[model samples]
Target: MSFTDSTEAPIYAGLVEEQGDVPAEVRRVAEEVLREADRAIDFGTVGAASAR
Candidate 1:
């Protein structure tokens, strides 16, 4: 998914690069955070949501 607001290339190459090879549970939570951040960003602010 498109996470960052920038038009520049993403800092990390991919999800694997961003979160590393963590456990399933950790990865799940990380993905949720990413989604929430993206959601909040879409609404305008990074703090728009609790988990954003």
Candidate 2:
């Protein structure tokens, strides 16, 4: 998903490289954040992203 967002590539890459091995709970929230990012960006919504 983020592979298409060049603007987010660096950050995504760093996240993968750094916290890719996080615990299950942390990974779950991270997944939620990524999904939310996609939801916000895909919809071009403003407030939704920060609502988390």
Candidate 3:
């Protein structure tokens, strides 16, 4: 249930690669945002199920 898994890791890496020349700060922020989004998705799904 993690975005860091084998399946998604390559896709994420590819995204970063495609965005070549991205600023260091921008890359850092992008990673942080993606991580937060992943966490939100995980928590939201769990919360929804628990509410059922």
Give the TM-score ranking, best first.
Answer: 3, 1, 2
- Highest TM-score among the candidates is held by which one? 3
RMSD of each: 13.1, 12.7, 11.1
- The RMSD (Cα, Å) of candidate 1 is 13.1
Task: Point out where model 2 deviates above 4 Å.
Answer: 1-22, 43-52
Higher-TM-score candidate of 1 and 3: 3
For candidate 1, give the lDDT of residue 29.
96
Model 1, residue 9: distance off in Å is 38
* Alpha-carbon lDDT, every model: 0.62, 0.69, 0.71
Model 1 residue 21 lDDT score: 38
- lDDT (tens digit, per residue) of candidate 3 on 1-52: 6443547687765665676535666889999999999977776678789889
Which candidate order results from sorting by lDDT in descending order?
Answer: 3, 2, 1
Among residues 3 or more apart in sequence or in different chains, the pairs in candidate 2 whose N, CA or C atoms overlap within 3 Å are none
Top candidate (lDDT): 3
Candidate 3 has a TM-score of 0.38
Q: Kindly list the per-residue Cα lDDT of model 2 for residues 1-52, writing each as its tens digit.
A: 6542546687766665667635556979999999998977766555787787
lDDT (10s digit) by residue, model 1, range 1-52? 4444234435533554677535666879999999998877675543566675
